[model samples]
Target: MNNRDQKGFNANDNSNFNIGKVVQNFASPETRNNSETKLLNAVKNEVALRLAQSLHRRVYVELDKTEDPSQVASPWSMDVKLGDSPSQECPEGTHIVTIFDKKEIGGRLLILGAPGSGKTTLLLQLAEELVQRAEANAKAPVPVLLNLSAWKTQYSDIRSWMVVDLKQKYGVRKDIAEDWIETERILPLLDGLDELMSQRQETCVQALNDFLPDWTGTPLVVCSRFEEYQVYESNLGLNGSVIVQPLTDEQIETYLCRAKCDWLWEAICPDRDIMNPETGLARSPLFLSMLVLASDKLPPELWRQDKSAKERRRILFEAYINARLSCPYRGGENYQVGSKKSDRRQSKRKPVRNPYPKDERTKRWLGWFAARSVEDAQTELFIEKLQPYFLKTRPQEFVYGLVYGLVLGLVLGLVLGLVYGLVVGLFVGLVGEKSSNTVETIKISWRSTPRNFYKGIQTYIVYGLVIGLVYGLVIGLVVGLVIGLVIGLVIGLVVGLVLGLIGEEIDTKISDNQGIYQSVTNSIICGIVFIPFGVLILTALHYFHEPMQLSEILAQGAVKGFLLGASAGGLLSAIEHSALRITLWLFGYAPWNYSKFLRYCTDRGFLQRVGGGYRFVHALLRDHFAEHYDPS
Candidate 1:
């Protein structure tokens, strides 16, 4: 061994120069290649494992600082990747923050930013960490990976889905899943109302109103396209937010260099002048992976193969990863729940050459990959695939929703009517008494004139309002209690039975869909978005609960207090009715009724039968409940 032959480690060469020992370990070309391949595989494994770990760990979650709701949907981080030393010099206080510190005093993190701003990537990284934390705990090793995309449209009733689906599919007993998932307690995380609703003005503020109360026990992190979720950030009063910004050129270079492949560095380092060069776009994990693969094969000079860099890069990405997933609908089969009927997606795509011509049975494979491409022109109606409900029922969701809501509407009308009746009834009685000359009328006044009594023992306003309120409340409570209990029990029993038994079957026929969720969420967010405003409803039954017991009720009660009492139940019934109407409206959109309305004939005979037109239609009513529905 010559010391002159080794420039860096001559002493090590002198200690052992056994080239035979290093090279003669394998006898055959296959064995040697296998051994070399194993070494390469081990090296590759370490790099991927380390890089993936770093990608997750290096993610910063800055805590504290009040955020603008508008700022929330911006990149949750001004910069997602570790940037390079600025070419123009680093700005002070940039990339320095309390990101690693826990921001517990505030609400759950609401990661926001523009599309492609790295919010989802960063959150997935964070989720990886959370899942680890849960796994490390002595109990509950399996961490649930909730896809917000899937979650926004998952079984709306998660409890039933988990219990029923798990039992049927996984053979896991409902009891076990309930105890372990504590699903009801964690419903808040799965509540993606913000995502489900259209992200526009006042959306964030509205979403916050709906979301904050829904979350519990576990920490929550939401990722949304920046502009979309900014709607809620301000109203939520979140203590902290991080906006992800695009990586600078130098940052792009540093990442290129750190890829530690001479191939990658040379491939991406030279795009100094082009706007958003393919190399510069490599900040994204999706793009980053492409760079690694392209780097392995192409020279630095070859990366500039396309003249328009941005266009070239688009092609580059498409060439590698297919398309960026814009919706859960676009994602693969795993995202979907199994349909009872087999997916007819086969008839969907115009089958050309099978990507994997070797496998004749592509459809049968659950997660099979077939590279064949199916192209559709932009103007085709087949591009839109509707959920099963719209396909199965011609359009009955609205009808069901409307009928259910109308059925429940009687309750709302009764409540508001009682309030109207009680006040009106009392005012009439007070006025009657104050103006009366009868000795009997003197004690109990039915109608009274205004005598602004300030302990002169009763102003007409006070007396009338008080008496009417009291009588209204007493009668309303008795009526509501009797009616509500009977109605609720009967309706609930019938609905519950159907829902519990045939519900699994019927539920599939009705999907709340996005609009329904949004409507309910909107009403929730707006506070009055869910209120019923129509008035001048029938008030006949509200005057008294069968007038015979009315005197007995008023005789013992304080009119004012009792009216208020009656009003509470009425208000609840009203609120419930309003909520039901909103849901029904969602099911049976009014716009869809035009076709049926148009079918009506305007003939003289038809008019005669229908009571001469508009008045007849208004007066006549018919229920169209299904056989499953119990009128009681």
Candidate 2:
């Protein structure tokens, strides 16, 4: 016999076996390069798509910057020192991309700004430029924009977190993502530093400092609010930092004119006090955009009111919501009531109808979402991540658990039996009540057969033995041993072989809708697989004990199999989630169709879509809604 027969296979023995190296040996360097190129292109496209969605077709404001010592690591403590030249200071209107290229800065940059100061916008713009360069040159590092807020819950190690983000968000293969991070092929553009809890901010900075040492050659950009960042004792070990300055009076005038907000400028120009540089709402690009969007609906007298900057901002957000709701639908052509041609077309085509809730209802729902997000320290809101705590009241929680358990138990019990149903219902209800807040990310894919035929047979043999033992015992207790042993052996062997022939894997495209679709598909597969097993069991039992008609036995078995398989597979989970969502709707916490509402909010400029989830366009707006939230 060969060495393989004498000595069993050892995966760690590279001389004998190594799946990765074996594959690599077969793949040419050119093929590897082409694969990497495709991955980089995908990363670039994802970044570009995010930029377009977040920017919302708004004009790019030329933000000014100054080298701020207060928010940056001291020169003496720095790994790279800024030269003793006054020119090192970033002049007004210096392109952000240029700042990264400066030898003194060396691409490790910290961006600091106040709330609503356009820090994220600046980072996204920089990312766009870097992505373009990476796309043009294969040697350049691909830019990836990630929110640091996920670090608190997902991972402690920055490098591991980055690899997972690339895999989860950009659909990069795990092996490829790991290779890129290890080789420093991607520039990390991390945002939302201030979104972490106050206590964890210092720890996060320390983590960044630790991570930066290993990532010496790679470019890293981090963004945070100056106020929150300044309080942290630890500072990011970066080459240099720049603070975003507020818009000056001249810049404000220029932007207003470009936006065709002449009426707004005319109104603001008369009251110089209202435009105070320190307290003015117009100093921030975000508030300015809101002003421009809501200008027509906002009466001039509201701007003239003597109110604190905070109060004025609140008023602007309220006005903006009202304006968006009152305005005619901008999504498509409005079919007038008078035209018969339009009516006929609308009837036949079933033109898309507006899905937005009423103005007040929309605000309330948004407020609840924002409030929950703040409490959970979550920046990106995934619909699947909604937890039991979201129900708010004890009664609501009890109802949710009860309903979830009952639905699951009922479906499962119908196929199994009454004893199984009661036991399952009690167990599920107890588990549901004590369920943790974290949502486990599920991945699913379909395959007709196991990849390895021998391995499949080995797995099925074990499965068959266990199933046969249990089935035989149960059947023997109910009927004769001869019949029990024969039926159990046949049933177990058939079921095991059938199951072993099928396989599953994770779908790399991690999106909310994609997940739901995969879950449904898995349920169908489970139903189909179990149909034959159910028919066999029911038919044998009827023939031995009750002597039912063959047709009746077969029909009953098929129905039982499908229901049991589908429900146990994934349909039950879907049902539970939907039931909870409906309960939340009943409580007026959210709409029944959360995905649709969130997408609509994105279109209205209140939220931005990030991968499969959504986040408020700005933390400032989210806070505004949270502060004014009245659940009652």
lDDT tens string, model 1, 1-632?
11111121111222112223213321213322222233223323322322222222111111101222211121222522111112122242333123312333121444554433455445544444544433343221222323232222234444444455333212233445564345221212221223343533244344433444423333344445555543333423232345555555555554444444445555555655332532345544434434443443333333564556455554453332221111112222121111212123312334333122221121111001010000110000110111112212423434433433443344333444555645544443223221101000011111222341222233333444444454445544657655434433332332222222210110110111222232233323222211111110011223423432444333322232222222222332333333333432354322122212211211100001110111011000000011111111
- Where is model 1 more than 4 Å wrong at Cα? 1-101, 104-107, 113-118, 135-144, 150-208, 214-218, 230-237, 270-280, 296-310, 321-632
Point to the candidate with the largest TM-score.
2
**Candidate 2 lDDT over residue span 410-523, tens digit each:** 776776676798678757864655332221222221322344655775698679868887898787887877668766776677656655654432233335555555556767
Clash count, predicted structure 2: 0
TM-score of each: 0.33, 0.75
What is the overall TM-score of model 1 with all chains considered together?
0.33
